[model samples]
Target chain A: MQAGKPILYSYFRSSCSWRVRIALALKSIDYEMVTVNLIKDGGQQFSEEFQALNPMKQVPALKIDGITIGQSLAIIEYLEETRPTPRLLPQDPKKRAHVRMISDLIASGIQPLQNLSVLKQVGQEKQLSWAQQVISSGFNALERILQSTAGKYCVGDEVSMADLCLVPQVANADRYKVDLTPYPTISRINKSLLTLEAFQVSHPCRQPDTPPELRA
Target chain B: MQAGKPILYSYFRSSCSWRVRIALALKSIDYEMVTVNLIKDGGQQFSEEFQALNPMKQVPALKIDGITIGQSLAIIEYLEETRPTPRLLPQDPKKRAHVRMISDLIASGIQPLQNLSVLKQVGQEKQLSWAQQVISSGFNALERILQSTAGKYCVGDEVSMADLCLVPQVANADRYKVDLTPYPTISRINKSLLTLEAFQVSHPCRQPDTPPELRA
Candidate 1:
């Protein structure tokens, strides 16, 4: 491990960054936050300095164990490998696969399609409907999967990585005004996960860069 | 383990499916391939029968150990856990993080943005340019990352999960006519990875459903 507290490059409203925040809190790992404003100064993530840290030019990059890891799931996996307390992935291979499937369903399948960069290309006139359509389609599948997988949380009651992915994405859905009534399972799981300290403390509304008006 | 051979729900041309195919080949695992033509019959993946297996309605779902695993990365992770030999993920924590970072850089960052479904929404007129732009921009970042991390392979000489992701995305790049010259590091690594039998046999051109005109 590194000698000092690890640092996290983050954007308050980024669902990807929020996923990492929840993981860091869940593992009880204290870290410094360096906010990379995704909107201001024409997206600070594109800045040369930030680009050096993450060539992908995205936030939620963690400086830990003397190395910087980008990608929320990768950082969380590293944390799980090194920390192993209050495990975010189940032990049984089959159960772990389920957690990962749900996580990727959100992380890769849904989140990427509706993120800021894609939305920028989608244009202002179409962004709302585009995000709504994307989120609803993904939620349709997620709802069915969660029907069989949920037990107070996504993938049983463990509050695994899937929960980390779920809560932030649901936040995005809310931002885009996607009707959640049709996705009862997703809505129920998000509601239950919101009550946890990890999810509460790591929420976008509670982050350092969260605007005063948006802060909880 | 299950009494019978595992089954892979796949489409020949889906990069995501090709990813799982490469992993299965590397692990030397015996599995049955059930082709789900993504285009035929208004997209077979959307069929109720297929949705029952993978609520996400995506190819590359694996039925292994008596449970259905969706998402290529999730399936690959499961195979790595159970098979272990000729490991797809490195054992070192930091190295593993790098492998995952690269894998996701392509899988989530690059692939989903230009996928057939996304392109369908992008429309036939804009599909080519749209795919070119998405792939080129992603490759710009990936090329920079690979400049430092790569050595014969994406992360050192070993063929980790990152290589599995790189080769398939490079194939997609080829299909889209994205100039490979700008990304020498990625091109070189991909060129080396292509020589392996696992990559050749699992290639989109050689799959069971590969059209006669497109077959190598």
Candidate 2:
């Protein structure tokens, strides 16, 4: 085992990073946070040091067990494997599949289309509309799925990884001014998830590198 | 367990669907293929029946163990959990993290950006260039990560989930005419993976729904 606290390289406003942050908090893993300011200095993630750590040049990359792991879901799954308490994935195989399906719908289907890098490629003039359309379309599908799957949280009331992904994407939807009126289930779950200490403490607004003006 | 063979709802040309197909083949799972042609009839995935199976309206939803699961990675993970033979994930924690990281980099970071839906939204004229650029950028990082992690396959000699994600994506990159010269590692791995029986049988050109003119 690694001697020191695991290091989490994160950006304050990145939804992907926020997902990892919530997982770390939920599992009660003590770790160090190093800010990789995605916007400042033309993205610290592109720097030689950070690039060496994570060739993908994205945050939240975690250093633990003497290895550095990139990709938020991968890192979280590692934690789930090693830690396994206050479990982020459901125990039942089918319930676990629901958690993963919901998580991937947001992570792959929704978030990637509207991320900072993709937005930059989308160009300044069309970014907002592009993000809004992507989020709305994804949420349309998500709302229908959640209507069937949700109880108190995504996948039958368990605070699974699906909830971890849900809250952050809802925050992004809010940022993009997506009309949540059509997604009552999503809105309700986001509201319910926000009340938890793990979610509140690990929120983007509460992060160490969150801009002073944006801090909660 | 379900009495009959598990059903895989798939489109022949979809990279995401191809990932699941490769996994199902690798596990030697007996499955029924139900075609959901994305192009014909304005996307069969949009029909009420398909939407009920997968609200995300994406192909490669799997019906197994009496539950329907969507998202390629989710379905693959469920398969790994249940079957566990000829494992898609490594036994070691760190190695598994490596496999998952590479898989997510392709699945979330790359495939989603250049998917049929995103390309349609990108508009007809710019689709080729948009896909080329996205695939090239993502492959740059993937090549670097693979250089470090690869043995006979991504994360080691084992044909892990990372390989399942890689072959389909490299096929996508080829479809967009992205130059593979800069990514020798990826090119070599793709060449090697193509020799495998599972990859061969699961290929897009070999799919049941593949157009007659496109069939291998």
- The lDDT per prediction is 0.92, 0.93
Q: What TM-score does chain A of each model score against the native chain A?
A: 0.98, 0.98
TM-score of each: 0.98, 0.98
lDDT of 2 by residue, A42-85 (tens): 88999999998998899989999999999999998999999999
- lDDT tens digits, residue span B191-211, model 2: 999999999999999988899
**Model 1 clashing residue pairs (backbone):** none
The residue-by-residue lDDT of candidate 1 on A131-183, one tens digit each, is: 99999999999999989888989988888999999999999999999999999
Worst 10 residues of 2 chain A by lDDT: A202-211
Q: Summarize candidate 1's per-residue lDDT along B153-187 as a digit string, tens digits.
A: 99998999999999999999999999999999999
Q: Which stretches of candidate 1 lie over 4 Å from their true place?
A: none
lDDT of 2 at A37: 93
Q: Quick one: best DockQ, which candidate?
A: 2
Residue ranges of candidate 2 with Cα displaced over 4 Å = none
